[model samples]
Target: MTNAVFHWPVSSLVQITDCHLLATPDALYQGIKPYHHLRLVLDELRAEAPLLILTGDLTEDHSADSYTLLQQLLADWPAPVFLLPGNHDERGALDQLSQQPPFRPERRLALPGWQLWLLDSKGDTPAGSFPVPRLAELECWLNEAGHQQIFWFCHHHLLPVGSFIDRFDQQDKAGLLAMLKREPRLRGLAHGHCHHAYQYDLPEFVQVGCPASSVQFLQTPDWQTQDQGPRACRWVFTPDGRLQWEFLQF
Candidate 1:
């Protein structure tokens, strides 16, 4: 590990998630339209060329057509794209389209001196639950990197973003938190699924919720409410290990 911290870093990174791109015939959302504004966001981010970390939900119905559309959308990205699995995304489809291994291991990579750990929190069913072995593996990874700056990406949020979302939250919150407590090097935890941009300050780290690239969720209490707007985010990672995030309105 490099103990050297540069006063100025040249490279940066961005984390995106919850890009629910649904096609026709997806029973879950029938008439729901696609968020067209994502195009504008993609155009802007393409200029920065930062490490685009897609947390989950690449497609709405997990259909091949949706994946095709997603491919076209990100075809021109200038940076390395890392995708994780979401509840809506079919693992088989993602593995096939992304052609990368699943995010189920606890290993260290030379990511500009910042450790990136992608944990699989998507349960077998729609409800989110941390798989036993995966959870244990993540805990061990965190413990090993005692105070090295790290960024964790998962499909499910460890905390309840809201009541409607609470039901779909990660089941092993205590276990996740316990592991976080042991790692003082944890910089932040970012995820997707709530369809809204939110940040929660935990005792161990900051919880960042990225907005959906396709649509925005209504902030009202009524679940029946809906909003049609394109959204995205650009996360700038400084060399000294400071992160700055900005939401892009499409």
Candidate 2:
């Protein structure tokens, strides 16, 4: 994976995930018009104007036309945009956006004092998995990074959030957790797919779930809707390696 280094005046990023947009503009998912909701969220995010990280499930139909729609939606965005895949996304279809501006496929981003590692946790099933090759690559990247503060962005939650969605959590959690425990420089991890905004203050790092830009799911034993409109997550990186974040509701 290529690494892109940016020396920005401000160390901030916006994460908008799980858009689940369809090819048709007015199509609805779970009674929510995803395209309309995502447009509203993007409009609200225009003021922040940070490096945008879209954490996956970009298309519900996994169609090229759906990706084309996403491309059009973000065509005029001013800042850099990074994208990852979710269970509902097709890698080939998503990669086509990389040929254009604002849609970057680079997995590693180098900030001033921090390194952002965007991992692809989309596996065969709804649950996530880190195959041997991916784990080895990550291990090498972590070692080469050499004490730089690290932050991870992926589509699957690394840990359970006490809900039915837990069944779809990353399948190789222990392997990832082991790596996190050994890497003291790792500061935080942000993910989507839960469609709910929550945090876990681990001894090694802070893990946060990004709210969906399309719709949200209630965090309960059984699946339910969280009709709080569309949302996003904004993360600020301090010079001292501390991280602060908040949810953006539209």
Candidate 3:
């Protein structure tokens, strides 16, 4: 996210993540079908939106064809949607799919009251990192647009959420925290992949963890069966520049 070409808020934004849709309709992922739940969430998203962001893990099967199905599902949607590739994704396929209409794949958004920097943290494994390039890009954005209140978005958590899955927290979290200390313009952040909802405060901003659109993984990282439920995370920025978030469970 080097620069921001768009200006101001259009409408409320909905973030859908960890959909894990399959290539086949009858496919079972960890015994749960996420595409069905995705449809239900879409039905609930009938309201107007300025933008919609699918924060990755879009397909458990990682089938390039699944994006075609997703395109058809979003064919009638009016608001532009962007994508962020997750660890489970093949970036080549997603990059190609996003170049088409409706999926802009834009990284920087300057809302009426907020500036959004969407980062891709897909590293070598489920755990994520802000690699040299990623960190450099962020520094560039902050240098140019940091005067505006900023909200950072990514596919993985920045810090451990105190559960077993803490193992999957960003490997370079210490670096991230120090960078945040240096950039005072950033106000908050939101992320997906934890499969659980959380709200926590940092020294300067708040961090939110979105619930998954498929099964909810056990908060404790230990080997457990799973928790079943699907939901979408909504970010509401008011006229006063208040960034509020709530999980809409389907």
- Of the candidates shown, which would achieve the greatest TM-score relative to the real structure? 2
User: Could you tell me the C-alpha RMSD of candidate 1 in Å?
Assistant: 5.1
Candidate 3 residue pairs in backbone clash: 9-112, 164-221
Q: Candidate 2 regions off by >4 Å?
A: 1-9
Candidate no. 3 TM-score? 0.92
Q: 1-250 in candidate 3: lDDT tens per residue?
A: 2244555456369998888888865677777777777877777786654478888788887886677667767776777777888888878877876777777757888777667878888888888877887787777777787457788888988877877767877888776777777767777678887878889987777888888888777766483435456788888776566778878887
Q: What does the lDDT read for residue 9 in candidate 2? A: 52
Q: Each candidate's TM vs. the true structure?
A: 0.81, 0.95, 0.92
Ranking by lDDT: 2, 3, 1
- Arrange candidates, best TM-score first: 2, 3, 1
User: What are the Cα lDDT values of the candidates?
Assistant: 0.66, 0.86, 0.77
Q: How many clashes in each structure?
A: 1, 0, 2
User: Which regions of candidate 1 deviate over 4 angstroms?
Assistant: 1-10, 24-35, 100-109, 143-147, 224-228
Judging by lDDT, tell me the better candidate of 1 and 2.
2
Query: Which digits, one per residue and each the tens of the lDDT, describe model 2 over residues 120-178?
Result: 99999989888888989888888778667889999999888989999998998888888
